[model samples]
Target: MNRLSDKEAIDLLKHGDILELGQQANKIRQEKHPGNTVTFIVDRNINYTNVCLNECRFCAFFRRENRKDAYLLPIETILQKVKETQEAGGTQVMLQGGLHPSLPFEYYLNMINTIKTAFPDIVIHSFSPAEILHFSKIANKSIKETLQDLRSAGLASLPGGGAEILVDRVRKIVSPKKIMTDDWLKVMETAHSIGMESTATMVLGLGETIEERIEHMRRVRDLQDKTGGFRAFIMWTFQPGNTQLGGNKLSSWEYLKTLAVSRLYFDNISHIQGSWVTQGQQIGQITLAFGADDLGSIMLEENVVRAAGTAYQMSIDKMVNTIEKADFKAAQRDTEYNIIRRF
Candidate 1:
């Protein structure tokens, strides 16, 4: 099949029949993954601190430094979480937090080093582009230098957070103080250039138009074509509860339609993960038929979505059941998308 053009993607997203789009997407997914297997990772998202400077409007997780509830977890606490993750059979630790102002650059390096030192087997797929940019400024170094420093300190990969829309118009409205489109892309590109692999993500219902969503995917696809460093493309709906950008959630139909379009658009990307965290299990199950080959993260611990007032719990048994009931074999994967176990 010809690679989807920008106009073609936009047209499919805007006007194509949802079922047809899903069928096309599922065909592509099956072509890439002929095994009829769906994967999930046993990981934890340990938000070390809620204190932030770039209080993005769409987030309910961040707090000002002086806020009574704001916190920066001690290195001991972070290590404890990593210990728990290891005990719980988790292979990855996603150590994401807000942009704390007073924390020195060495704080992050120490955090990564300490975690890896304590848990040598755990994959530290932590940090975001926004955090990287913040670290660069804090360390007075270039993006490459900052990433190199982190990588040397045992940072395994990055999570595609803080890339809500990846268009400046929407970004300026939702997160005026956060890193903009070019900066986010540059951070990812630089990370890729240094051999650090990562995932790409999109949160729908951020008030971005169809064209802008396609544009976001275009940038990611173009970069993947160059570096081939992105292991997966994960898409989810924006949870609006308790957020400053409070609004109704986008319909699951719309979410699935866009997801199918993403599967079609990102021909160069490998995995398309369904977000059971944001959309619940039923829709997450439906995502398999719509082109998703993986249900991301049996996230052992997640607070960001809970802070936004959306919470869904999943365990190994539940995750396996969710996938098996959908008629696909369920397996646990590591940070690199390597199958570690089968159910």
Candidate 2:
């Protein structure tokens, strides 16, 4: 295939035939992976607090600091969840939360230290760019200094949340109070510079133009060209059930088409994750043929998407079966996308 330009990507997204897109994407997936193995991680998403200061219009997961339901999970409760995840054979914990108004920067540092101190083996893939930026502002530090401190405190990697769309125009409408496009990229760039690798994500169907969708991918692709720190790229449709920015969900066809295009466009990035949590099991299964090499996680728990009124659960056996039925060998992977065991 010729080099995929921005105009070309948008054109395909707008008018590509579904099967053709999948075929082209699957061809790339075969070349990139060169095997019948599809990977998943056994992990849990633990939200420490839901008290956010920057209440984005697209979020249903955050509450004002003094709201009746607002909360910060006690350290004991957090540790207990970690214990449960460890007992369940989970290898990683995704510790993401809302931006609490008054939580000292030390609170996050100690949270990382506490988890590492207890579960030294667990990969603490925690925090989004927004949270890190918030931490820097509250603590009067630079983004680099903040990430360095978290790394010292045992932050293993970053979960690519908070990157709705990299276009400032879409950002202004959806999440004006949150960090803008440049700040999000700067956070990822800084993290990469400090030797802490992370993933990049796009939450589509936020009323962005087809051109804007490709624009988001282009920014990530350009950055990956420079830093090579982005280990994978994950794209999911925006869930708009209970949020302030309520809208219809994107169709499965659109999701799969976008996923396929992403696989073809991100030629430099190694892995593309199929999101079962939001897309459901069967569609996620189809993603293997649509250019996804990984089936994402058997999330022990997920609340953010749940808050948006779409929830799907998968046990380890179910995850294995989904891949098996799709004609690929199922393998458990770690945070770095290394296959740990095959089923």
Candidate 3:
């Protein structure tokens, strides 16, 4: 059967015919990866600073520069986190932080270089579209130049945060200060044009229309069509706890339905992630049967989602058992989404 389009997707979504969507997407999932094995990364999120200038309504992680807990995480603390990640058998360190307005471009370059200099093997998958855009504007440099500099300093990839929803309508409402949809796409395209690959993510249940949700997928699909640099597409319900954009959490069924629709709709993208951080391990495991090929990460340490008061606990053994209970094999992967070890 042919996969559904926008209106068809809306119909499936409304009818909650997620099983049908799952069947359609699972066909493709099996076609691409024919096995019970699901992949995850051994990574830690090293939030360099919580001090942010663009305080989006949906974010509870960022604080003012002078706030009590806000900090720039002097390079030493970041290195310590990286060391801790490595000690725990982590292969990647996600260096995600806020858009600190006063930090110079050299600050970031030095941070990347310093980390790379110490732990040459750790994959430095850092920054989001918003950070990149901010870097471009603050450093008075071109986007290409900024990305290239980071790459040269040993940044491996970009985590696709700040892409809450691609439609300007929702973007303006939630994240007025963050980069526009076009600028976000442009950064990814430019990064891919060089040699870097990245992931695409969406945070749902933030007052966007169903059409807007599908449009978000369309934008990601279109960009993937152009740059083939997306390693996987991840979707999770937005955690609205301590932020200005307070709302009810989207149900697991709604998240799973949209995830299945994303798989069925975006043919070019190969991987979809099951976010245990926000969805809990049970549904995260169920996501595999629902068309997700990867189970996100064994985040040794995480703060952003934890700050939202929605965190799940999992060690490698627990992660493996969770997937096997769901009747899938569990595997470990690196930053590039490449399988390193299978269990």
Off by over 4 Å in 1: none
Model 2, span 153-176: residue lDDT tens: 999888889999999999999999
TM-score of each: 0.99, 0.99, 0.97
Off by over 4 Å in 3: 1-3
The lDDT values for all models are 0.93, 0.93, 0.88
Minimum summed lDDT over a 10-residue window in model 2 is located at 1-10
Model 2 has an lDDT value of: 0.93
**Could you arrange the candidates by lDDT from highest to lowest?**
2, 1, 3
Show the colliding residue pairs in model 3: 36-329
Clashing pairs in 2: none
| Predicted structure 3: clash tally | 1
lDDT of 1: 0.93
**Shift of residue 61 alpha carbon in model 1, Å:** 0.7
Q: What does candidate 3's lDDT look like per residue over 46-120, in tens digits?
A: 888898888899989999988998887878888998998899889999888888878888898999999999999
